[model samples]
Target: MLYVMILAIIVLVYVLTRLYFLKREIKRTTRQLNELNKNATAKKIDISYFDRDFEKLAKEINNQIDLTKKAKAEKRSTENELKQAISYISHDIRTPMTTILGYIQFLESDEITPEMRKEYISIVKNGARRLKILLEDFFELSIIEQADYPMKIEMIKLNQLILEVLLGFYEEFNKRNLEPTIKIPDNDIVLRADHSAVKRVIENLVVNAIRYSSGTVTIQLEEFNTSVQLTISNSVDQLSEQDLNHMFDRFYKADQTRTGKGTGLGLPIAKSLMGKMNGRLTAEQMENQLFMKCEWGN
Candidate 1:
């Protein structure tokens, strides 16, 4: 009986030793697995096993990347085409316009009836002015579209500059039978801007107001702690939401059928000029009126 019991004890000890080594081996394998996972993550490897789901996801990602690349290429091509079209159109229009102006000058030099001469003179003047406006708009658009243009900024008195621009338009206001009410502070309000660009912005707004307004247009200047706002309000027929939204877009005319003569680039040029000067131009519609605002930082 003693011999049997000693054999049993020896067997039990052997079983316990085997279990201890087995547990150690398991711990080592687990540590190695964790280290492999860390290395894979650090290297940004797609260590996922190949499955139907993974294949589908990779296909989707590739398609999205290809789509984005195609869209960018198409956009660049469209812009290039637009630039070429503008160049061709401007050149073609100038030839006939110049010829018309020359013919009108010859007619004026020759002896003619007063009525015929006056009519021809009016037509010539209008045509010349239209051609000039078109050329100016074309040049402005090219400048704005160029990637590199020097933006020289300086501090300018906002109210004084606006006054100067309005003074230049006084005769136009009188001719149109419209009244301009200007409200400006006595003290000068200074804003950091490009003077030429800012002046063009105000001039465009004033001209637009005169073109659309029926009787009176009001100009107001207000200075805040960090910005200055110049608002030009004009009384006009109610405008649709669509017109308000595209008021500053290139070649956008509010009245489709009411055309006399314009390049339809005034507001767009003004907006682009304002952007170059680090300013903003916006329009607001109210009851029977439209308010165009040009704001600049102090």
Candidate 2:
């Protein structure tokens, strides 16, 4: 009977100690939760002692907390982008609208000569044309970024297609006396992609080069064992690292102050189309030249 009593006392002490630990753990978790709620801190709950069920609960809570924080961060980022888009849209649209309106007002003056009148009309027309291009680009970008954008896939001959695109601009180049040097391998590079999308990408690249070139532009097509590359480069006197970095970003005019031409959406649209076709588009600046490169796997 004495031995039995000693064993029973020892068992009771163990039970009491375990209960005390469980209670202390619960209190700690509760306090931590209260602090988190009060301060919005990104902290996980701490349990002083381990219990299988309690540990699992803490793990689940931590996971949920992480998820919630991630969601909040993403929401904030999206909100900021939306705000920027709104500002850019307002500024760009307002510029052309103001020009068109101001020119139309100039057209109303009766003392202007016939040549001046004709010039003002042409200016108004150009402003309207620019506005149209801007709106179309914005609309097209939205469509291309959609997940369900439809593209007809086929084998595209890069050599022929690129030549066709460049030829399309031959007249303009001749007028400006800025014809670019072209280099391509005799062997053809056939890539399985959306032909229309590829043509658009190439067109944007060529137009970008011509628009920014000082007096020279170069177009080159090369093929590797496993990949094909297209490089378009032009001389630039005032290009900066910041310009290179944001060259692919939407509404990123190299020098936002220079307002002569370019919708600033061409490169962004090309990048989007390239991404959809499993291709890569990148820009590099070297000394006084800027190169835009597009690569695709064979």
Candidate 3:
């Protein structure tokens, strides 16, 4: 009878101890839950409970909360980008449209001379061209940003494409009074890319060079271990580091203070298209030259 009483007392103490711990964990979890509900930006769930099950529950809750925060951050970033896109579109189109309208009004004046009328007509035509370029760039960028956009990737002759793009700009280069030196390897440097996209990227780079070149332009191609590099460089007297950094930014104008002749979307479109083709476009402004580089895997 004495031994039976001793064992019964030990069993009762163990049961009470378990009950006390369980109750304490429940109370602590309830308080944490209340605190979590009250704090909008609390990033963690603080649990002091010494139970495995409760710890597991808290960890799962924290995991879910972290996922939610990540999703919210992504949504915010996307929203900001869309807002910037809209603002850029509005400003770019508006300025050119206003110019066209003003020129039209000038042409319609009652006592305009033939010379003045011809000049106004030419101005209107130029404005229309600018508007068209801006709209086309905006369209291409939108297509690139779509989540399900597909690229028809294939092997392309990188050197041949660069030569072709440069030759196509011969007339424009002549008009700008700029002579570009082209250097490509005798052997074909082939790369895996979308042919049309690659052509467009090179064309954009050449056009940018022509637009900003002060004296001469240089186009060079070289091969690396796993990729090929194409660089188009031009002399520029007054380009800052900030300008070089934001060169590929959407609708970033180096001369934002003045109404310049670039759509400001060329480099950005080129960069985005390169990314789609598993490549990259970058720019660097050295002492008196701006180098535009395109790198793609072989």
Candidate 4:
């Protein structure tokens, strides 16, 4: 009977020792968790627990901490982007508005001749048209971002479609003194995409080329093993790598000074539309030349 009682005491002591360690580990982990939650300066959760279960719980809590930090970073990035977009929009609107106002004031001048009056009126009209186009692009971007916006994707012969878009821009090209060298496959290059979306992408690229090109514009279509790349190459007097990098960013202008008249939303919208179509739009700069490439996956 004495031996049995001693055995019982030993068992109880072992269990109580384990319980004591378990409670200590739990307390330490709780303290670490509370510290992490309260202090933004706490970069990581630090705890040493002998219990495997407590260690696992610490790891899970750390994962949550990491997720929270990442979410906060993303929120800050979005806020900065929103601020930049607002600044760009205001600058863009103000430029054309200032021009319109100046032209109107000139029209009221007493010494203005008939030819001068006609020129002032024409300038005002152009400024109004530019403002209208910018507003429309903003609206179109919103539509594209809508989750439930219906898209009609079908098998489109991209080569033929590109030709049609180029033809439509013939007058604009002539006005810009740019006769693009176009190379396309005689064979039908068919892909599944939205017709209107593809057309808009091509048109935006062509317009961008016309606006920024210095010497010649060469547009080419080539098929790779898994995708087709449409490249628009143009010569520029000067362009930086930074410009190439942010060219597709919303409201990012190569000429940040706002000397160039562009809404700066064209490339961003085109990029977003391409993403919706499971494609990509990228840019590169080579020896005073800029190339905008649109890739469509097969």
Best of the candidates, lDDT: 2
What's every prediction's RMSD, in angstroms? 12.1, 3.1, 3.4, 2.3
For candidate 2, report its TM-score.
Answer: 0.85
Best by TM-score: 4
Give per-residue CA lDDT, model 1, range 204-273, as digits (tens): 8999999888777999999999888999999988688999997876556687532344666788888888
- Candidate 1 off by > 4 Å: 1-114
Residue 92 lDDT, candidate 2, scale 0-100: 83
Tens-digit lDDT string for candidate 4 (118-200): 99999999999988988898888878878876778999999999999999988988988888999998998998999999999
Which lDDT value does model 3 have at 66?
Answer: 88
Candidate 2 or 1, higher TM-score: 2
Local accuracy by lDDT, each model = 0.77, 0.89, 0.84, 0.87
Cα misplacement distance, residue 12 of candidate 2 (Å) = 8.0
Model 2 has an lDDT value of 0.89
Candidate 1 all-Cα RMSD: 12.1
